[model samples]
Target: MQPYCKLKSSTRSLSKLVACSALLLLLDLSRCFSHHTYEWQDSHTNERLVCKQCPPGTFVSQHCTRDSPTICKQCPKLHYTEYWNYLESCLYCNVFCNFLEEEAQPCNSTQNRACQCKPGYHAELDFCIEHSSCPPGSGVAQLGNPQQDTKCSQCPQGTFSSVSSMDPCRNHQNCSAQHLEVNVPGNRFHDTFCTACKISKGSEASDGLEDGSGSEDCQDAVIDFVPYEIRVPRRLRRLKRIVSRSSQSSKRDRKSLEELQMELHTYLVQLKNTEKKELLLMFITAGIVSQSEVAPFQISAGKESLQVRRK
Candidate 1:
């Protein structure tokens, strides 16, 4: 019922009389209800009553009555209520993730379950497929994630992809830039194969050779157990001899192999043009280190790896 207010004083100002009635009307509203409530007509008394809404995770089991308040009940398992509601029953969980999909967020009293693709897979219409493997001569343009698939692209010129993998196109080994002779040029499928010891043309002329020809033979190189005739450079011969002599597994021996290999590698890297030893012995495959640099490993036998050729 509305509150009654009568400003009977003739001495009272017009603003004061309006304020008195407004205050009494606000008091009547406070006595009825506040936020998060609704008015309903009581079936027994035929009177309107304001009832509070049930909080999240619970629902109104019965409406407000003249003698009793609105009755609320807790949601059962696998059911949920998001906010203050007068719903009779909580919502049921109907969504389910598939085999290839993983639950990103578990279902709770307030939120629904969310799913996404697992690792190495990407989401499609309703399911997920495995990420694409970049084929030989092709490469991954973009890496795949939970929502997107791996993008593939063909290897461009001067680059190659030798394996079926997710990696991108690898820059081909630049033999000319490394000051080495290119025996087999690089394509999209394979990398440039460079000579093991000998340097290519155009290098010696830069070093004051009148008519530069990189083909210079060596009499000191030898044939070894490997298919290629491994040749030690003139600068590295001393270190190779020392490593060959060390038989005991001492601290000196531990450092000897590493030092010898490093010295040999440094000499080969620095040895350009005329300084580079040309393949003298007519071996089908010739290399100072190993023929296949892709699978290059240390030759443990220092003596056999660097034995001097006899006269």
Candidate 2:
């Protein structure tokens, strides 16, 4: 019983020794973990640190001692710091939008610039709108929406538009019957009338004007007026007055010559007619004389015939 008690005591002591050694090893590991540190630098490179690195998305603007971590500041207003142990200063924010006044927000070291539309100008699409009305004689055909202006056009000459718009033309010619031959088709300002062309004696026209005054070419009418030459009888030609260039012949001499020729021609025609009349008279006289002579012979023949018949 005494030997069994000594073996149990030795075994118990060995277990206690093993437990104490494990406890010492754990304490040593804790001290090593506590002593673990990282060197850090400030943005100006003027300060130093003896601790772990700063967190991501944050930058150390100033160094810290063993008792304190580095002073980490957020990036300037709208900007952000995305680096670790940043040796440079924090960046500023960029403009959120642009402006036409040239007073837009400026971009920063860490952000890009932006743009936007102005007031009274809707940016529904990519265009601007002016809800202004059309001028006096003009009107709008298509009324623009919030993004576009209302388009207006002019009222044409013949058209009388009460309102200005982009509408099509309307007012037309007011031609009526009674003087209405054919409506010369056009706008209201042009020739729309109740007039007609002239109709003259021995001439005609499609418009209301005299011959040679109308559309007919005067040159063309002259061409039709006179022929190149004319012809007359030889007897009439002899009666025409002739100008004499001879020294002995006066102007009156040529006139006398023409008169003489006309008289000669007239006498020749009269003589020919007289001869024809005398021959007709001679034939008649011969016919009467022959008839008388023949009648006496017939009577004597008849008497002879009667005596023979009596015998």
Candidate 3:
């Protein structure tokens, strides 16, 4: 009985050891199954656990992990990443700008380099634009360079420019004259230059018409005789009477004053009568001469004739 009891005890111990060993084996299997496995895949495989994250500026379509079939995708061309740990995909870069000197800052979800425009280029919705030119005569030409201009110009001759940002002037077509009677050139308009007429050629009362040559008429010299003619009459006859009196007054001064006085009075009376007749004769002669000169053909004709009648 003792020996049988010993064998039974040994068998029970062995069975317990076997059961523990089986339990240990099952735990080991469970641990082996629970631990993560690394899976390196070609470009198209997908994985679940321990999947890699996509890189910056890149998007991942699938999750990839260890030891399973994984889809490991590279970033598109022109793309880069800062890190590589668990990176599911690489990012795509921005399009290249030929005219820009430097990269621009990133925008939106895309991780790209910013593009900077060169000098003299303005930024417009992802593009660089050139500046516009100002119009002539607007006074824009006087401005500094690199200015964005819409118009430019200069002032006319008659008019002056006040603003710097002005367009050039249109040709002045409406020039004006300074005075009347001056032949101002026609077709002067729109701020054309103004000119005065020649001093001698223009007058306040003269007509505005221009002759073949521009000149003025000179004034003629004048003489006056009618004012002096009527004041002194019979001057030559009076002088002739004085001369005759002087000639007749000979050497009888002291002897016979009464006789001398009588003779002088008589001579003076005769001189006055003679002077009156001479004045009548002067009027008659003037009348005759005037008539003859005015009517030379009206003189009556006469013929000298002698006739003897026989008895």
Q: Highest lDDT, which number?
A: 1
All candidates' TM-scores?
Answer: 0.46, 0.18, 0.22
User: What's the lDDT for residue 277 in model 2?
Assistant: 32
Task: Point out the worst 10-residue segment of candidate 1 by lDDT.
Answer: 202-211
Residue lDDT tens for model 1, 220-254: 12211211223333323443443234333333443
Q: Write the per-residue lDDT of candidate 3 for residues 1-311, one digit (tens) a residue.
A: 23212334545788776776777788766654454223345455442344444444444555553454334455566665644334455556655767543455653344556666655555566566553444322344443322232334444354433223334444433433334221212111112222222223111221111111111111000001111111222322332234253444333344233223233333433544345333222322433212122111111113111111111
TM-score of 1: 0.46
Scored by TM-score, the top model is 1
Better of 1 and 3 by lDDT: 1
| Residue pairs with backbone atoms closer than 3 Å in model 1 (clashes) | none
C-alpha lDDT (0 to 100) for residue 159 of candidate 3: 41
Residue 61, model 1: Cα distance from true site in angstroms = 3.4
